[model samples]
Target: MPKMKTKSSAKKRFKVSATGKVIGSQAGKQHGMIKRSNKFLRNARGTTALSAPDAKIIKGFMPYDR
Candidate 1:
């Protein structure tokens, strides 16, 4: 059988955690930081685990990741 291909965009944007959760960078930090509050900026740092529904979809894209 032919190998199933991973989605290129998904590979770049998301990662699977050791416990099988989807890990991704926090959103809304790419631009216009001057208008964003300090608390928002502080909280947005680093990666976050995606919700169950969202992680299920991401897992579909990365079949071999788990």
Candidate 2:
């Protein structure tokens, strides 16, 4: 069979963790941070693990990552 192509967008946006979880940057922080609460900004400061359902979908896009 031919090689499977990884989704370029997924490769750029998400990463497969060592334990097989999908790690991605938190959403809603790309713009308008001035309107957001300090707590919200603090909480969203780092990468987050994608939820199970969401990770499943991302995994499909990155078949070779796992």
The deviation in Å at residue 43 for candidate 1 is 0.3
How far off is residue 5 in model 2, in Å? 0.2
Each model's Cα RMSD: 0.8, 0.6
Question: Over the stretch 1-66, how does candidate 1's per-residue lDDT look in tens digits?
Answer: 989999999999999988998999999999999999999999999999999999999999999999
The TM-score values for the models, in the order shown, are 0.93, 0.96
Best by TM-score: 2
Which candidate wins on lDDT? 2
Which lDDT value does model 2 have at 28? 91
